[model samples]
Target: MKNTLKNKDISQTPFRRDVLKIFNSHKNAIPLSVIEQELSSYNRVTLYRTIKSFIEKNIIHEIVISGEESKYALSKENKDTPYQQHIHFKCRSCNILFCSELDKAITISLEKHKIERLDIQAFGICNKCNIS
Candidate 1:
């Protein structure tokens, strides 16, 4: 965690550390509501700014959802690099999203266009959901 903060040049303030902790504890992208619930003291504006800063620093990546609340997940690479190509699975039954790496390399070409990042999400039932 310290390495991540240092790499991003973010100060190790208590609030910032706590916010980063929340992200570290979860393997999936989470909504702001979850963070608010987990932390002791909640301030809407402060949380917003923290999240904004994290995003700008490439410490986290926003997950695009359809007709649902915004969610954020930790980036694959720490420093502003094109996020490692990976896949995110969103369980349709439980509404939980999990990230996983692809076993084989993927190549994409966009004629005359450059790609900064690639986000791929698949929706289905998670293991827990499938069991119950």
Candidate 2:
């Protein structure tokens, strides 16, 4: 976690570290409410600031699901690499958003334009939801 902060050129404050830890521990994208439940001691504003800083530093990225609250997850790609483009799967029943593996790096071309970043999400009932 400390390495991530250093790589992102962010100050390693206790609050910042704690927030980063929360993202590290979770496998799926997490929302503010879930983070609040885990970090009961910290207030909303502080958490918001920490999240905003992480976003600016590229330590994490936000996943937006329409009609639902925004969720955050760690940015695992290296700083030197081009913007990472992958897929996200959102479970309709449980409302959990998870990162998906890409068989190959996604690429796109538009005339003379080059695509640097992309955010794609697919929604359906998850395995757990299907089993239940």
Top model number, TM-score: 1
On lDDT, the candidate that comes out on top is 1
Q: What number of backbone clashes does candidate 1 have, counting pairs of residues 3 or more apart or in separate chains? A: 0
Candidate 2 weakest lDDT stretch, 10 residues: 1-10
Judge candidate 1 at residue 26 and give its lDDT. Answer: 90
Per-model root-mean-square deviation over C-alphas: 2.6, 2.5
Where model 2 places Cα greater than 4 Å from the true spot, the runs are 1-3, 105-116
What tens digits encode model 2's per-residue C-alpha lDDT throughout 1-132?
433577567778888888888888898899988888898489778888999988888778888877889999877666687655689998889987888767787777789987677677888999999999
User: Candidate 1: misplaced stretches above 4 Å?
Assistant: 1-4, 80-82, 108-117
- What is the lDDT, from 0 to 100, of the residue 89 in candidate 2? 95
Q: How accurate is candidate 2 locally (lDDT)?
A: 0.82
Q: Give the TM-score of each candidate.
A: 0.83, 0.82
TM-score of 1: 0.83
